[model samples]
Target: MATDAAQPSLLLPEAGGGLLAALDIGGTKIAGALVDGGGTVRRRARRPTPAGGDTAVLGAALDVLTELTTHQEWRSVAALGIGSAGPVDIAAGTVSPVNIPAWRGFPIVERVRAHPAVAGLPVVLCGDAVAMTAAEHWIGAARGYRNALCMVVSTGVGAGLVLDNAVRSGPTGNAGHLGHITVDLLGEPCVCGSRGCVEQLASGTSITRHAVAQGWQPDEGPADAAAVAVSARRGHPVALAAFDSAARALAAGIAAVATLVEIEVAVIGGGVAEAADVLFPPLRDHLAGYATLPFAAGVRVERAALRGDAGLVGAAAIAGAATAGAR
Candidate 1:
């Protein structure tokens, strides 16, 4: 890795070319990075995710990456890695992101390849959850764990599984979508057409919806569930109840996964988990009630170490890992 201090850009060393270029396109943001072999992002840029049909979203992502690649220092990057909302078609280099409806069945790899800077470089696409897990394994919270689950409990719930020290991407590269697991047969309807799914009952959106229905009003805009966490911090009964409801549902989901996989740890992240102190205690207690076995009882639940940058860093890890494996 070489740094150009004057330019605030990174130059990844290639056998003959340069550094690695990574892109992370999520439902909320698009971030690009230049990473070294050790997974440190030498250069980074981010922009809010644009909402629209597929073309508009792809254009937004391209605009962000194009701006990042404009820095002369990133011109010679060797590869590009993409981490996006899944059910991605890894074999076909396409994706049908759950959050971005327009991207359904879009040829993402080809679209990214069209970018001038990354045109010929090897590009690897992966589910965002899997990418997040890879980032944690590469340099974040789950580094020491051979079997861990990294999950996001934000606008929507999603997860990636790492088993036996390996990131798991089952057929179609869309494994470990834990949020869809049904915890309550009669629970709320999910966007995925499932009822009582973990995401339906425990996601940030669900929490806020639950609170608003209980007569809680957020002082800030949008009545975001994040604000409900703020209200809970002030001991608002409505907000606390909202969180408790989410926790109970999430705990059931966790216990079910632990029962099936015997995962060693659960690394939780996303906007909702910011209130870890308020949320985790109840979640742990609920989980205790759900799990009957020792393994499930010992399954430690922790926080995701990486913030928003986890996706980009994870993309870099995937690119670097794939490059190494190929060699």
Candidate 2:
């Protein structure tokens, strides 16, 4: 977790002078930003996550947060919000991300509250997928929808639900965690101690593992999902098969979600989603077969609109919700 002084940027008002501090904490990176009311990102900083140490990782996150304070607009910041990799406990203000094993049940809310520069403001927490759902529902692809499911298909599959016109992050902040849902109840063992979960078949990590195990190799670097995507585009049989399997699994999971929540849209984003040309067609085709029920057939699948900014925008939205609740 090595960091140098950050170059700060100043953000004036886009719509209003109301500003918020936002943080997006994942297993591999921590990003912080100052966002105004209009979804404008005024300033941002990122720090690489350190491996295997809770204190060091928290220090890296704090470094990113401290960088946000260097902005000229810091004085007007009204609240703070964090979208963290979970399972997060909103009531306990703690998180225990499987990727960040050292932080079992870590009390993140209390620690952020103690940071002198940003303390005293209301701090909010939500799972990363729920945060993304909030951002999309607020201004991105899900804006006009009354119900939706938004997903991130990166190192693992994660998703959240918007039901009855609000993000349903449920108690303990782990609701709408679509990855661990058993799509193939008798298929393969999942790391979440479940069998045939969508994450076991459809995540970027799983895709990469399947490709390599089937003898798909890049000419150089380790064959990740991105590499597999490239090979699939080149018409490699094994690569294409991997994507087909993953896409089908993803479709099954989406169909299940639609059946349960009655969502109108399914928005997807993340590194793995960058391979849509290889994944989307098969996903749509498979979805038609799985979503046989009348209520679920109309669910429209879509690509995420905000891309990299979604996480920060979503974090700000969480804080904005808190600010409104306090009124």
lDDT of each residue in 1-327, candidate 2, tens digit only:
111222111122223566988888887688998888777788999998799589998999899989998888888888888888888998899988766777889999899888889767888888888888888877777777778899988877888888866788888888889888888868887767789988899989899989989999986677799999999999999999999999999999999998887888899988888998999999999999999999999678888888777788887778777667666
The list of candidate 2 runs beyond 4 A from truth reads: 1-16
Give candidate 1's whole-model lDDT. Answer: 0.80
- Per-candidate TM vs. native? 0.92, 0.92
Off by over 4 Å in 1: 1-18
lDDT for position 266 in model 1? 84
In candidate 2, position 198 carries an lDDT of 89
**Cα lDDT for residue 255, model 2?**
95
lDDT of 1 by residue, 192-243 (tens): 8789988888888889999999999988777887799899999999999999
Error of 2 at 321 (Å): 1.3
Task: Look at candidate 2 and tell me the lDDT of residue 174.
Answer: 85
